[model samples]
Target: MRISTFLLVLILLTSCSEKDKHPYTFYYWKTKLALDQEEKKALDKATAPYLYTRFFDINKVNGRFQPVAVITENKSFDTDKQIVPTVFITNQTFLNISKEEIQFLAENIHHLIEKKIKEYHLNAGQEIQIDCDWTAGTRDDYFSFLKQLKKISHKGVSCTLRLHQVKDKALMGIPPVEKVYLMCYSTSSPLENSDKNSILDVNILKSYLSKLEDYPIKKIEVALPIYSWGIVTNHLGKHKLINALSQNDLKNPNFKKVSDHEIEILKDGFYFGNYLNKGFMIKVEEITNDQLRDVITFLDKKIPEFTIIYYQLDAKFVINQNFKLISKFQGDF
Candidate 1:
């Protein structure tokens, strides 16, 4: 009875100060999964101890023409933040979203945002952030797209730009981007005995980042991969193609389920011959201590103000890190 009474009092105190005032945290969902009640509880329990220490949530909105919010994640929303939440639309194919499309999506998104806020009985936060990875070649078009997004979105709408691999001297002047996310990972696999010149390209990226010294560091974020991926190719499909695949050269997924004919085709050297002796093997890459240190060391010196965003909540490839000391990230061995 005493415990229950104390809990009620605690809840009342917490209810009085739910809205938080601080920089928001933006997290991208690598894959769409329907969140469940148990899972939601698990998450709340996991982050409960942190409380206002990390007070923000980034609900990623992904898809093409469908304009779908397919990720229906369940959360306690009992966060220290009073803001409803923020959204980051992740896509870059369209040269322009067009005023018409922005106008259309805004209508639907507003209601969704409102419903979540009401369901949680909390004040929804201001602004929507779109995530686009475009290049200088399409500078004009990208700006045009941002204009459309800003115009149609609620009053304080903004966007995030994915800076995976950029030239040191790509842009002359700072354009309009709420935050520029430097993505330091490859869609492919990591190479062995590499100095990580390909991913973060430390020396090159640092030189280019120097030019952006005038830009707002608060708006800069770095995409550090907590995940790893090896290469997986369909030998059967590649057989009819021009370029053959080298198995040993790339990390291959387990293929016990692969067809025998595919293996035979691979053996013939038409596809996946880069690896020796039916050597089609996959090399799984993770956030090794050396790789993490390499990235942290570079970013600490190059772009210190940028927030380090964990790519997703969890990916088969991502490392679930909680301790800050794990600057040298550790994952499945």
Candidate 2:
């Protein structure tokens, strides 16, 4: 009787301890910061401790790289949640920046970010995340900018990691940051003719993660995709991306269901600001709950403990997810 009682106590303690750990974080990548009803419900359900907000983007304006901050209502949100500002930079923008302009770029960028944080009153969170899909040509400039940015924000710094960067570490040298958030989605190109999912392919994910064990980075987290998109291919076989379009949007009589994903456009006109040809095909790509579960299980074996940030908190995706299961995958259960 005593042995059984002791075992039960141990189990209870373990469960309580797990619950006490920080809840998983989330990323709000939308240009507008307002949260819809569904998004608010999802955020409440997840009970996330950190919210990584995309403050602005760095794009090339004329011949100069400038910071374009996204407009956020900044009116309603949970004040208890910590905010981690994220800055996105176009890879081409770094290529345009001259060697002598690196310091100027870094200083101006940091000032712009600081202004946004002050305006939003997001002073509680100390960590700042940099989101850039850097390439071999821009790696030197990107890394140098990171080193400079670190001097401005003395707090924790984190950058995103793509699968290709993980595979080719020689060409994609590590960024000088405190933390690296491995983006585990977008493993394949949606423009390709393949039937496999572009968002999350288990086999492709395994291939990249197999090399993760050898990755030199120590502090690492993961960002998963919870959203979906449609790839519109014209008669010329050129692909154009359409965001947040659903099956209901394709229910028009002009569209014929070719396959589960592919849709044949019988009539061509202006649709979503694009000139749709008659032979246009729209392929819908998404990650289902079961697929997400499988990914969590796979990662459970490889990385038992780490932070998880959903791609973005969209209403459609958040309204349909099982928050309990997602919390479990984040090691909160």
Give per-model TM-scores: 0.55, 0.89
Writing each residue's lDDT as its tens digit, candidate 2 over 58-145 gives: 8887888777866475487544567788899888888767866888877877787788777777754777788899999999999988
TM-score of 1: 0.55
Q: What is candidate 1's lDDT per residue for 172-207, written digit by digit as tens?
A: 223465655566655322333333423334454455
For each candidate, the alpha-carbon lDDT, in order, equals: 0.43, 0.78
RMSD of each: 11.6, 3.0
Q: Which runs of model 1 end up more than 4 angstroms from their true locations?
A: 1-64, 74-93, 96-102, 105-124, 144-152, 164-175, 187-218, 233-279, 315-322, 327-333
* Candidate 2 residue runs with Cα over 4 Å from true position: 15-22, 77-79, 96-100, 269-275, 329-333
